[model samples]
Target: MLAVESRFTGASGLDAMGAAVADALVPQRLQTPDPHRFTASVTSVDLGSVQLVRASAPPMRSVRPVGSPARPDGAAFLLLGRGARGEIAGGGVSAPVDPDHLVLIPGDAAFEVTYPERVEVVFVALDAPGALRLGLAVSGPLRGLALPAAGRALLAPALDAVQAAAAAATPADVADLAEVVEGALGVAVRAAAEPVADPRAAVRAAALRLVDRHLRDPDLGPGWLAACLHLSPSTLHRAFRAGEETVAAMVRRRRVEAVARDLTGPAPGPGVSELAARYGFAGGSHLATAFRARYALSPAEYRARHGSAHHLRRS
Candidate 1:
């Protein structure tokens, strides 16, 4: 828990705090009444399959405003309110945050949250694919769903296990525990909310599924997506209006992340230039520019730091 965690403390400026929080959790715009006296502390642990983040701050509002760039990795969050109280509004959902219930916010959804007093929150970050496999519904208007009592009963204990594992579990042990958490989350997701019936959400889902399949195609774009979906380009673009990202942006993000996985995976394969070409980048420099914009590191540097045996050998 204490070790193997990234920690941020005594951040005096709002931009500094925001960047730290974004690195530890998701990207958002953070504001407080008194910037001069502001303070926040964030600690995060990466468990390979999932992430645990705890943040403490004074009264503030965090917003991922509509039309803002979506989170590049497209991760969702399970938020547990620990101290004080707060409210979240946006993405077609409004909810209160308290210890009595758990809140689920969809990936890359635009929203705003206000902490009325000094607040503490713990968040579990899950990627889009894992969330879907666990039966957690990620489609529909970006909304926050509060788990019902029965669903809460199912998920709370698994979350407790995650917290405990962060304290002292071995990496392999934590990975095993992540699987358990996923299973429990799946059950809870099924029990929480019914499938949303909005047509826009449906279109968005269908388009995304197609995008996943065609990510490697350089011709994949808004026009291509619209053509395949039998929708007008405008309609296809409208489907994503509520989520604050264009189809082209999502496609590029997905491709970059796919290449990132290749860079960091255990077994070594192609050179960065070859990988860039495979992923639709013009060359190694093109991939490096895009990769750095999202991950803040060049391809070679990222591989050297996070890659496994073959990567280390090459390094």
Candidate 2:
């Protein structure tokens, strides 16, 4: 869990903050552009797959580009507070981050994030798979723009949940919550991207992607997803009919598949309730109910039979 590793109100504190920022993010250059003394506080959590950092700092300019180790390995999402403001430019594209928008920074790609004023933001870093699944790695229409109103509405709660979970969650719990957070972000980002040419197809793609991201949330459904994607319940239904599986089936399948993947993966364990909670199941019983419905074995039994103790990591 992310704890307060350092806090300072003056130059000394800022210097320490700079070192902390570098350690948490990467080697980078920082500058105070306004000649102001400001207090900065940063709390961070690393969940193997992602690092979540919350920082409250004065105005500063940050430049991070392709450096040693060849551009690092992931992307970052900056969820700006209501009063936050900044500009991030890189790869020939520059985007402004006023109170209205969040920003995405690709680690491998050179970029500069400048906070023109004091800002409080939740910055999330995800590995390549997470970045691609969230669709933040591509230069889609929504790639670098401000999150739309609808997107922002959904994002706030997810960010809050993640922020809370980061500080108090166990490593296992953090991983699960990270998945949930990733799903929420994917939907939020997808919503802001340019809509596809075919309204029906676009909505379907977006709706399914949202469902895929939140498949584990017990509340995930047509109504909730419809609102997230700015579609009506009926529209959502129609979209699903045109697809291969109904929305409910897709959600169930995805959750079951995810659980199965985790169960069979190298770590080989999380109690039933713990595992269930990760995927939006109401509890162990709920997961067992679903697990039994979809597969012959119960979650526990299934894990016992197929679980392995091997974990693969990036080199």
Question: What would the per-residue lDDT of candidate 2 be over residues 1-315, giving only the tens digit for each residue?
Answer: 543445656766666777887777655666775434757788877766667777777888877655523223334444455457777777777877664666666454566778877887776777544554554443231235567888788877777777776676666686687787787776776777833134445456556566666666767977787666545688778867887888777777788888888888666366677777888877788888888888888876777677774332211
Q: Which residue pairs in model 1 clash with each other?
A: 1-166
Q: Which ten residues in a row have the lowest lDDT in candidate 2?
A: 68-77
Report the number of the highest-TM-score candidate. Answer: 1
Candidate 1 lDDT for residue 290: 88
lDDT of each: 0.71, 0.66
Q: In candidate 1, where is summed lDDT lowest over 10 consecutive residues?
A: 2-11
Candidate 2: global Cα-lDDT?
0.66
Candidate 1 local Cα displacement, residue 223, angstroms: 24
CA shift of 87, model 1, Å? 1.1
